[model samples]
Target chain A: MIEVNDLTKYYGQKRAISNVSFKVKKGEILGMLGPNAAGKTTAMRILTCYMPPTAGSATVGGYDIFDQSMQVRRITGYLPENPPLYTELTVKDYLMFVAKIKGVEKDKTKAEIDTVIEKASIGEVRNRVIGKLSKGFKQRVGLAQCLLNNPQVVILDEPTVGLDPKQIIEIRELIKNLKGDHTVILSSHILPEVEQTCERVVIISEGEVVAEDTPENLTARMKGGERVLLELEGDEKQVKEVFRTFPDVTAVKVNKTAGGLLKVEVESKKDLRKDYAQALIVKKIGLLEMQSDKVTLEDIFLHLTTKEEAA
Target chain B: MRKTLAIFEKEFKSFFYSPLAYVIIAIFTLITGYLFYNLLSWFVEQSFMMTMQAQQYRQAPPKFNVNLHLIRGYFGTLAFISLFILPTITMRLFAEEKKQGTLELLYTTPITELQVVTGKYLAGLALYIVLLIPTMFFMALLFIYGDPEFLPVLSGYIGLILLGSTFIALGLFISTLTENQIIAAIGGFALSLLLWIIGWGATFTGGTLKPVLEYLSILVHFEDFAQGVIDSTHVAYYLIFTIFGLYLSLKSIESVKWRT
Candidate 1:
C-alpha cells in the first residue's frame, strides 16, 4: 500500500522528476516501466525515505515519508540500484546485521533470515563470502536482505539487469512468487519483463507518467491497425488480380520472391487472413505461408515515450 | 540500545575482516614498545650515573623521578603518536559507508541517526583501546622493576583516551563530509593537527583571544590529565568538544539526506 502525490524533485538547477504520481494497491505487483534516467530510481528513493522530495508528499503503509519516516521505513524494504553490500562480510553475517537493524525479534532473527534466504533461494551461498559470489547470487542476496523484517512493501530497482537469460527467468519467477503477500513495485526498462511480471503497468518516460493500464488493456489501447504477410505459389498476374475480390483490404503490395513465389503484404483495418486464404484455396493456388503482425508491446512503449518529443 | 549495538557490533567486527586492523595494532605496539624501551634504558643509565657521581662527590644527586622522567616522557610520545594513529581509524567510519552505498541501508532502516553515529564512534574507541592494551602491558613492566606512581600512569591513560575520543569525534565529522577515504584521512589529520597546535597562537596574541585560543586548543586541556590531575574543567572541555563534534557529524549526515 503506497500513495504518491504530485512528487517533484530538483537537484539544484536540473529537475530530476516532475509532478510524478502513482499508487500501489495492497498485494498488487506494479511495474514502473521506463528507459534509463527516467527518474524511476528517484521516485523509489523518495518513497523509501532515502531522500526527501523537493515539493511533494508520499506515504507508505499509512506513514508519511517525511513526518513518520521511521515507521514508513520499518514497513518498506528497498533494494537500491546497486545492492548495498559489505564485500568482506559473509552472507549470513550480513543478513544477521540487516535483521538486527530492521528490528526483528532478537530470538527470531536467525529464523527470519532463514525464511528470506530460502525465499530468495540463497541458502546454498549463505555461508560463503558475498563478494565472491556471482552476480545472480549477489542479486539474490540483495533480495534476501530486502525480505528481512517481513516488510509489506518491497521496492526493487531493476532487479533483473546485468543477469544472464536463465538468471533473469529465475529472478522474475522469484518476484512473481512474492505476489499475494508483498506489494511489489519494480522498475525496469524491459517491456516484456514488466508485462509478464506485473499486474498493473505504469509506463514512465522523461520523468512523467505517460500511460498506465493492464498488459492486455495497454496492448489493446496501443494496437491501432494490423499488417499481414501471405506467400503463394501461383501466377503473379493472378495474385495481382485476386485483390479485387476483397472489399475490406485497404492496401496491398506484391513482392516477387526467388523460386517463383509471390510475397503479398496486405494492410487492413480488420482480420482478413481467413478470407484471403479461402480465396486462394478456391482459386487452386498453393498457400505456402501466412503470418499476421499485431502491434507489439515495444512499439507501444516507444510510441508513448517518444511522441511528446516529436510533438 | 539494540539498534546501536547492532551497528556497533557490525562496525567493530568489520575492521578485523581485513589485514589493515592487525597491521595498525602491530605497528603501533612495536613503535610504542621500542620507544618505551629506549626511555627506560635512558632512565636507568641516568640513575646509575647519578649514583656514581654521589659516590665520587659524597653528596646526594637530584632525585630521578620515574613518573616524571620515564612514564611521563613515554606518555608524551604516545599522545602525539595517537594524534597520527587515531584519525586513520575514524577516517573510514562514515566515508567508507557512503562509498559502499551502505549508508542508504542504514538510512532506510528503522535505526536512528544517533544510534548509527554512536555505534561508529564506539567502534573507533574500541580500536584505540585495543591499540593501547599492549602499551598497558609495557607499563606493567615498569611496575616489575621500578616504583612509578600508579595513579599518575593511570591518569596519563585517561588523558590519552580523552584525547583520542576528541580526535575520533572530529575525524568522524570530517568523514561525513566526503566519500573519498584519502581526503577524509588527510582532512581529518590536518584539522586535528590544527586543533592540537592552536594554543601556540596564544604566545603571539595577548588579551581575550589568547585565553580563548588556549581554552580551545585540545592539547592544553590534556595537560591536566597527563599531569595526573583529573580536573573537572578539563574533563568538561573534552566532553563538550566530543559532543560538539558528534553534533556537527549528525548535522552533516542530516544535510546529506535533505540537501541531496
Candidate 2:
C-alpha cells in the first residue's frame, strides 16, 4: 500500500536518513527496529508527510509525498514518540476534535469517536481531562486519536514507551487486533515488542536498513549449524572421548562439575543430538540434560545492528 | 470553511479551559473599566469648569465639546491596551504548539497552513470582541448623559477592532518564528510600538522624509478611522497589514518541520 524510493532527509549539515527505500503491502504488520538516533523517527515523519524528504521521493497509496500530501495524509494515521495531546481537553473532546480534523462527517463523527475509544480501550477515561490521566491513559488517548479516522495505514512510533508491563501488553494486543483492517508500521527500540507484534521486521542502523525479513526467517538466517548444551553424568575426559565417536560433531567444550556431572557444549555440522545420545548410551555415559540453544530476538537485533556498524 | 470552524471552536474552547484566556480577559476588563471611569470623570470636570469660567466672563458659555475628544480618547486607550494584551493572547498560538509538541499533530492532518493560521487568528479576534463588549456600555453611558453622535463612536470601535486585529496578526507571525513565547510577546510589542511612533517621528524629520515616514505609520491610518472618517485608503492599509502578517505566519509555520 506504500512505496518509498531512495528517500533521504538532512537537518542542516547532518543527514538523518539517507538512501532509504522500502515498500509495505496491504494487510502487513511491519516493525522498524533501530537504536537511538537511528533516523527511524525521521523516516516515519517523511512517510506520514510530517516532513519533506531532502532528496528522492515517497508515495502513500500512489500519492506522492511532496505533491499529493493531503491525499497521503488522508489515508495515514501517525502516532509520534511523544503523543501530541492538548492536556486541557477531555479524552472525548480530544477524539472528537481529531475526528473532525480528519474530515469525518458530522453524522458519523460521534459514532467513530466511540469506536476508537473502544478500540483503544479508553472507555473509562473518556470523560477525564487528559492532563489528569496517567501516562498509560495518555498513550491510549494518543492511539485513539490515530485510530479516529480508521485510516488505511497506521504508523506508530515507539507506541509502548513509558508504560507498565500490563499496559504494554494491552497495546501490543490492540495493535495485533488491527491486522487486516489497517496496515501497521510500528517503530521501537524494544526488540520483543516489535518481534511479538509485527509480521515483518526491518532492522535499521546508522540511517540505513540492515535487514528486512520475517522474524522467524531472521532468526533462522542467523541459525547456522545445530548447537546443544549437554550435561552428562560422567568424567569430562570420558564424555569428550564418547562425543568424538559422533560423526557430525564439529566442536565441544567439556566442564567437569563437583557432583560428578559433565557439562558439554556441542556444535554440530548437522543434527547430531540423536547420534550423540546413542553413543553415550552405548558408552554407559548418562545424559542428564540436552537443550538446544536457539538465538533469541534480542540477539538477532543486536547482531544485525552491531554487525552492520562493525562492517 | 468547515475545517476552519472546527479549528475555531477548539481554539475558542481552549481559552476557557486554560487560565491564560480567562486571566487576560479579566485583567483587560478591570483595566479598561478603571481607565474609562477616570477618563469620563476627567472630561466632565474639564467641561464644567470651562463653562463656569465662560459665565463669569459673560461670553457664550464655551460650547462644551466632549464628542470628538471622547471618541478619540477611547481609541487612544484601546491602542495602549492592545499594545500589551494582544501579544499575551497571540504569543502562544503557534509557539506553544511547537513547544508542547502538538504542532506535529496539526501538521500531519489533511489541512493546509492557511486554514490553521486563519482559524487561530479568527479565534483570537473573537475573544478580543468579547472583551470589547464592556466598553460599549461606556458608550451607552455617554449617550445617556450628553448629546453623543453615534456614528463617530461606531467608527471609533471599528477602528479599535481593526487596530487590535492588526496587532494580533503581527503577534501571531512573531509567535511562529520561535518556540519561545516570551520572545514572541516582546518582539510583537516592540514592533507595534515602533509602528505607533512612526507618525510622530515623521513630524520630527524635515522636508523629503516626512511623507514617506507617515505612509508607514499605523497611527496615521488609525487617526482617520478614529475621526468617523471611513477612508478607503486607511481601510485598505489595515486590511493589507493584516493579510501580510497572516502570510508571514503561514510561511514561518511551513519552514519548520513538525516533529513530535
Per-prediction DockQ, in order? 0.81, 0.52
Q: Candidate 1: list runs displaced more than 4 Å.
A: A230-247, A250-265, A278-288
RMSD to true structure for each model, in Å: 2.2, 2.6
What does candidate 2's lDDT look like per residue over A1-311, in tens digits?
A: 88888888888878898888888999799999999899999999999998898888988888998899999999999899999999999999988888888899999998999899999999999999999999999999999999888899999999999999999999999999999999999999999898899999888888888888999999899877788999899767888888787777788998878786888999887777778888888889888899888777788888888888789
State in Å the error of residue A150, model 2: 1.6
lDDT for position B22 in model 2? 83
Deviation from native of the Cα of residue B70 in model 2, angstroms? 2.6
True contacts kept of each: 0.86, 0.72
Candidate 2 lDDT by residue in tens digits, B86-199:
888888888888898988898898888898999999998998888888888877888888887878888888888888888889989999988999998998888888888878
Across A128-244, the per-residue lDDT of candidate 1 in tens digits comes to 988899999999999999999889999999999999999999999999999989999999999899989999998888888888888889999876666788889998878867776
For candidate 2, the per-residue lDDT at B176 reads 91
